[model samples]
Target: MSIKRILPLLVVVLAGLGALSSGPLTAQERPGPLRIVIDEGVIEPLPFAVPDFIAENGAAREYAARITRIVAADLQGTGLFREIPKEAFISSVTSFDAPVQFGDWKAINAQALITGAVSVSGRRLTVKFRLYDVFSGAPLGKGLQFAGTTASWRRMGHKVADAVYSRITGEGPYFDSRVAFIAESGPKNARVKRLAIMDYDGANVQYLTDGRALVLAPRFSPAGDRLLYTSYESGFPRVYLLDLGSLRRRALDEQPGTMSFAPRFSPDGRTVLLSLSVGGNTDIYSLDLATGKRRRLTSAPSIEIAPSFSPDGRQIVFTSDRSGSSQLYIMPAGGGEPRRISRGKGRYNTPVWSPRGDLIAFTKQNKGRFHIGVMQIDGTEERLLTSSFLDEGPTWAPNGRVIMFTRETAGAGGTSALYTVDTSGRNLRRVPMQGAASDPAWSPLLK
Candidate 1:
């Protein structure tokens, strides 16, 4: 089935499912927000000490240390945990079951502690771990254990981070999710694009579509099982929703018009928000698959493209030239007065609402240079996240902690690639691609 083919059916399933609830579940249940979970973003990074994991049985000593390091790195990467350096540990974890020395840890300003035991029997590996609140002198929760193939040590490491994060922050786990984006190759004039999905860290890459036809703006559903993209296969630049798993596609021309592009799924996966252009004028609209109905949310003479919904699904933030110059505007999802939410020297386009619903990240064209920026919901506190010849198409990660977009250089041999940056505008990392890439839309945290 095509992505939007079951799109109609998925909406039915989602209505019964409702907004994702909180809590972690087994493989049978989907991942959702955790009720009464720790707010990792607001909470201070807990200082924790994870001593070198103790190897029981015949586990490789080298592999055990690597697993411990990966676990520590995952926790630290979330910006929610501060790992105590190996030298700072005045005490060592002699055993996983041994009582933690709260006094000693507290003296080193360690707020939490991690201890684990690893054992290997034949091809199977078993890991048991515990987390503790050092400052409170109490166990964080019951010890967690996992049994899997010995080769899955890295996955086991991520699981450890998920447990530590979930116990302290009420938020759901995101460590195990994956992301899909366009992979590019060939020259600038004749670029080839392929649908590339990979684990969040760029591991386990799978090509969903061959880089033959022209494709643009692909985004995954919240479950990461489907993708909504715009393809020119219809010969007139119409939006086509393709099921990543089935190599099937159906044109999303709910509007009988010739052009509909820049497609993205609403947070609930019930509606697809995209732009419809007619007679040279473009506007934003929503396609309600369940009712087989569509609602034009923005009706203006000027161009209004790249419509993104707030996490609550009550309002939308989009790019419009209503002010004589392109800028960001926020309006009710049902259609109403739009308040301008972007300011400063240049025109803003492609405004994407962060999943956390606190900020609107967009591409700003200032002077002659293009830069990516984020602003408060009410249009206050704007900060640039990237700058260059052309930096555009900002997409927010599920946690709203990072922003991913495309960066294109200038000149005869212009270059473009996908890049991700923290909300702080730091840690700009270029994602690997065979050729040029653009219009990256980050997928919602998968269940």
Candidate 2:
């Protein structure tokens, strides 16, 4: 099932919460309540307070404080929430079941309040939290608990934040997802690119490649167990499928005279769509994983690359230079004539279908400036989210509410870094990293 269908079920079953309403309330109907409406303009962040989680025992004290800070940081980073300073609070939550002082929070104009507790027993850790609408003087949702290994405390914190964010914003949760990207090092002339994965917040980075060969565009499988990326280890760009569990990788397409790159998985994870070049002519093709069967999908004279499947796997969106310049085109997944979708005044490339199946994100180049932008599937209502000397390779979050891409500075000493922007074109911020990075692809939310 899609994340949209599974999210409500997760809340009811895993979190042991009551059934959620059939749908989210509109902003006009829920005015003065604890909610956020993501619109097309500047949004006043909703103020919230996350006090230090209560430590049930001595062993849980440090974890409690650290998890509390991470939860608050996750919400604050979204630009939809503002964390009230702890020093400004008049009341403290000393116990997990203590009554909330709604009047104190209201005095500080806090629209939402979060309270949590942590306990550590041997190697296992448990966390529980509750969200409150201060204006209503009542709990927004029933309390939820999560138990896991002590080493996974960070994920536990993210789970709490995801619950809180979903409850307030009425949007799907993205905090628990992961991102795969190319980590860069060394000088601009001899840069070393390695495959790496990390939490959506840029934490818990784990390198998958040794930086010996250049890797690009690491796309995660629907199940998040494998990745498809382009590697230049064999003197030509080729697609490689890597088993994330075993850290083993092999070339997916090794035709003697053909080069294959820019691979993405079908929604079912049984087929792969990639750009294949033969005798200087590039087109899109599909490869079956169970059998080494290859079928060409595009037969144009011009280059057709960067193909992506729609959410239902029935259609595809790709970039082609057949229009005299790079542009976006959509066609049936089984191969047919494509219809152009982009009619803007720029060259569009790297179009990715949003998981929600509503918008397509791409990189645009116009008048010597690069930008990250999105548009409807029909190519209407085009909106550019970011502009820089170099910004490309747009990747959608699991929830389809945010986009992450690479941005490179100008000049010899310039460096590439990862940044994220919400669909509203607000909350554009740099993702914290130790070195240069690019080609980011977000994974589906963990099961």
Candidate 3:
């Protein structure tokens, strides 16, 4: 189905199955009591408890425990919620329908409490959960239930965490999303690279391409069913579109004398913006997926690449060296005069527009050090969030509250790893991975 038709259906399904808020809070609304407000700067993580879910039958005993652990891990990883250890619990929940003893939870200093039940019938698994305000002695929100195959129990856990996070923070959930990146192995001088996709928390990793071809910048389509990447499989840098389910790929808008790379999809997924290099001069071009027609969006002598569309699809943000240093520029979606957006004293590249449309994340280099930073659309209020030997390729979470990027340490044996940071420039954590990884692109939350 076309993206125009599928987008609304996915939103409806996520609202019904995941039980997320149909209408989010407006900017004028004050945050709830359980909200983790960052408006005043850094704050301590909120403490919460998730007791082991009640196992409805023998078949669900193992799943019940595993899902509860996964749910706790998801919330704790955000650095916004702290999980109280099970050993410190003073109360035991034996029945899903039992009334909660809010006093028992409050004694342990847990501001939030989570209880759930798990059931398994053949290959199908079911989980239902509720969140409570321990001190208020009331349920924070309505109970939610999710069902899927036993193999997908982890996903159901993420859905529950997403719902809880949205209700408490007044922001969209990102736990149910995926990240596509380039996995690296071997020596730094001769690294082997392949395209890989995984859960948002760096679990369930699956490689999409072999190491025979060098690939860079694997970007997901708006629907998360396809990928756009630059590959050297054809002896020259070229753009290729790959189907995630079929494992099939084909060249994209190839031209005989020009090299194409750094491709990204429009918000509607019906068009693509790419960098086309001819005779060493590079510019940005947009291609219509339906008609195979191409239009040039940039016509400067300097190089321009890494084009990303605004959330509303009305404008484009890209990296350009027109100002004698790599910097960010914004232009109308249909092609027009560009305006510089990076005014700070540093070189910037890989400018990615956040899903929230409030900020643009980019990589900055100054004084021989690399950093990840974000700025408003007009390039004001710029803030650098991270600094390291090498930090680049900033991609936004589904909620736009956090960013994931590539960080490389110094030295010959030092390797690259994926890291996440909050937009406020706090809570930097390394993503758990077995090998070097880079060029992360986050997917929209799963339906």
Candidate 4:
């Protein structure tokens, strides 16, 4: 019996949460701590306030306001926290060491209050911040300070926001990371593509590769210092590994007449998983980078692609049509019998295992519509988070709380854009960018 024909059946069930619209919540509506429960029903976003950061020195005045604004934008953009406008403040904070007027903030319904100070010396910058519970009149945690070069002001701002987010949500921070994607220009048919990297918020964009070759799926290594992408530079799709620090790259798993694509690094960064086609058949393979050895993980006749390693590196989730339709499957990382995990009435592709190891995010096409959905590891609790003309390439944030993907309209004037949504299927928003872009792969939080 063929390996593909003997796999156990794990039926997929189509289920989604009903849309619930929530009005702006008052402080009284959410009277408990600012903890977000993803499994619970939709709740109103928490309200918070951030006044201008106090300048500790004459040279730091310009940075103080900019840093404060960036931090506020980061929190508000998540749809989990609403920023109270400065016009609603009844008291002003001028000193970093001054006690917060909790009563004034409470009067304005600010549940959380952020205060900070910025200092600059030569090219050095330092920022300190404190989070306070306005209702309880107590600090959320000990004050913290971060020091770095002045040129990295935005990163410093992200770090502060990460600290506050971690303290409040009890999840790891994603703001202090980067995203690698395909930066595109020109017409949709003859578009030029280049490998690009940018901050998580889509700022500080830097092109790593010129538009000389067609590159796709720039997957960041676990260490966040290398990239694995498919390039048609050799006139066929081949996987290449690029050293992010030196801007140098080399092809991998090159054979006489084989084509390889869909490359991703294993959790330990020691091995690579990719799809290799030979004699019109494609199967997943793993390569040890250090030894130049390869192992075929699947021996099925059906085309298999988009292999993603689980967090523990013990298993993998990928897409296959062995079941007569494209669906998701899970198997041992080293290769074994596979089991279907996608049970819906549609085609599921580009299955990405969540960083939290609890969910699998994928792109589904059904009823002439494209959707991004999440399901439990065992193929249950499927929830479609988004639907559009074209939505593909789902990537997760470092914390696994949000997902970023590619969305394109269906027309001659359609252009590709990046977007994000909370794991709870809420807070869908577009990512700001300069032009057409797609194929995003988020990196681990920067050290």
Candidate 5:
């Protein structure tokens, strides 16, 4: 196993409230195992054309065109589509309902076309788009519409493109979302940290907290409105819940002398599972947010951290040094003896349950290196996804086919950046970041 995945091995099931789509994701969505729906069934890159979208009332003729370009970039980024050059467009579209000249598009060997219109009213912007099968001269799907603030028009465009992808390929959409991570500054040895949230592709970065105090492991709620993290601002490490929308937070525990870390929300979002370290020994506990009740789930002299809930919220997986070295263990959410799940030459830490409920994702440290790995519930067929100098933090892509993690490069100027890889260990690419970034928590696909 590679040394890349050690943190973020905790299971997080984000039951997205407004998103109800089912099935895998299409190529026009976000990058993963993209499902390609071809009408002509060409093995080569499919050619597509997107003339500037129509705009009305001078609201911003360029807004529609800018949106079209973004949509084209989103589609072309998948390495599956070849965009027809804007210069190749012989004629122009005045309206979305106008007849598309197939001869012109076919001359340029375009197999698909995306036509849309953009309009702004008050402070809200509305974008409507439709996908068309150029060769067949038929509408591929119904027109998709998304409305949002003018500032978020780009996201609305991506959402529309995702909808087109879902309709064409019978898959899910992954655009229109955010990513929460720990923004770091200074050297790797003593870095200042704060909770920062940004758009999926590294836009709209908002600092949820100042970098004055040390902060670690910030995670987003299923609804993308709240965050749960561990802060040492109170002199000792304690779990703090910060509401991202209003930037308000209160200590999760009123208890004294109890240090908490590795906090994560349960599948249902009503409770949180965290490791409470007191007097050198650590145990896993659950805290109800509304009732403010605490339940101790594990009681052992050994060190245990990173408690993650299963998709059904019945079992919790955590890491323990009880095996002489750190390894993963699973037990009921309530207190009991934990059953060992990782038995191998290397040590494992940060075990996360997959939202699909098919496997347990974890980090393994072998031969002075770390890796991101996954295994079945019974601890069979252990597959390691990534291996690097210091690869850790495995968060699922909403579809479960890809895992996003942080890879720390070595050297004097060594810095950390986000990377995503498929379960097969193929298609590893650096996720975008603003300055040196680490500890990425992928949000659920937004609606």
Candidate 6:
């Protein structure tokens, strides 16, 4: 079937599945066949099972197994679903169309079941899957099929996993996204930093710049086709925009005696917000990409940096030391009187507005400890998600349910690495990287 036909079919199937519950529910009061309640307290991950996808032909056998494993890994990585080992299965899923042995799955306490099939024709690949509510002995949603090139098998797996995750949790999909970061090498004093991009799970690492120059704070454009970062190639910190397709870059706001850094793209991707330092003063300015015009957003003597636009482009959240200590503040998008949003004791920096627009994630340093935290847009209900020797530069996932940040160890030999945690502060784990990495910025879900 053509992709045009496949998408509409998938949408119709998903719609027919019915609306999902949005609030937390007790096990006894859970309204759906399967649900994951994200609460303040500890949560027991729902048990799930995904047998190897049935290969429709001999050529598809290997692809089927790989895709199945990827799907399971994606679900388990969320800390919301625990996969039941294949060895524990009482009955095997031998066919894609076979009715699931609900009693067999329930016996193992598998709350959710996933069945799939894979087929290959030359360079074309197709994946089909069904999610079941084991206890209810019914399909949670109609079966869905995805078609793509064989080289994109990994994405096919991610799409299936995204569908399963969203259906069970009532959250958006995030599995099929990319992350831009500063890949590091050499010793701490003279470390080499290069621009790099990778899959959300740190797969397919591709270096975008040579390590000859220092790079920091890679921010993805709204369309995910370009990046805004700071580079020291010209012997001074300056903002540079890099195009991913052409691998070309150009410095922005290149004034005679001014240095610019800490750049971020506005939600619409037409304007760039950056901190430009002239003489002894630093302020925030918005640069129009098309006309190369600069508009100052803050005219304060106190330093203001790390500005991020709200999803709707109506407001901006940034860090300023105007309160004597670094704290987060919000101002109108077009520059106006600022409102202090962070009332916490510690210093706050690198405030990133969540894509959902309900929360802002930031790095906080207090006493001798550093932390990554999130709070309501108004800065209420501040909750720290992580604390370490040096944790800074938080970036939100596309769905805003997770935050990825740079965490450095201590001492001279301390190395930086990337870590992710849910907004609830659960499932803290390091992303797999060959060497030290930091300053991660997640891209939006890929089209």
Clashing pairs in 1: 22-33, 23-33, 23-34, 37-169, 37-170, 38-169, 38-170, 184-435
TM-score of each: 0.76, 0.94, 0.93, 0.92, 0.84, 0.92
Better of 2 and 6 by TM-score: 2
Better of 1 and 4 by lDDT: 4
- lDDT accuracy of residue 71 in candidate 5: 84
> Model 1 compared with the native: what TM-score?
0.76
User: Residue 405 of candidate 4: its Cα lDDT?
Assistant: 96
lDDT of each: 0.73, 0.88, 0.87, 0.86, 0.74, 0.87
Q: Tens digits of per-residue lDDT for model 5 on 26-139? A: 336533222364323343556788888889648857588788877886666444567899888877888767777878776887777888888887766778776667777655
Every model: Cα RMSD to truth: 7.6, 4.3, 3.9, 10.5, 7.6, 4.8
**What is the clash count of model 3?**
0
Clashing pairs in 6: none
Clashes per candidate, residues 3 or more apart or on different chains: 8, 0, 0, 1, 17, 0
- Which lDDT tens digits does candidate 4 get at residues 55-155? 99999998999999889989888887899999999999999888788999999999889998999999888888877777877766667778777777887
Ranking by TM-score: 2, 3, 6, 4, 5, 1
Candidate 1's residue-wise lDDT over 323-382, tens digit each? 899988889888789999887889998888887788999999988999989999999999
The residue-by-residue lDDT of candidate 3 on 89-185, one tens digit each, is 9999999878889999999999889998899899888888888878877777667788777777788888888877877777888998889999999
* Residue 246 local lDDT, model 1: 70
For candidate 3, give the lDDT of residue 224.
86
> Per-residue lDDT tens digits of candidate 2, residues 91-173?
88998777789999999988889999999899788898888889988777667888877777888888999988887777888
Ranking by lDDT: 2, 6, 3, 4, 5, 1
Off by over 4 Å in 2: 1-13, 17-32
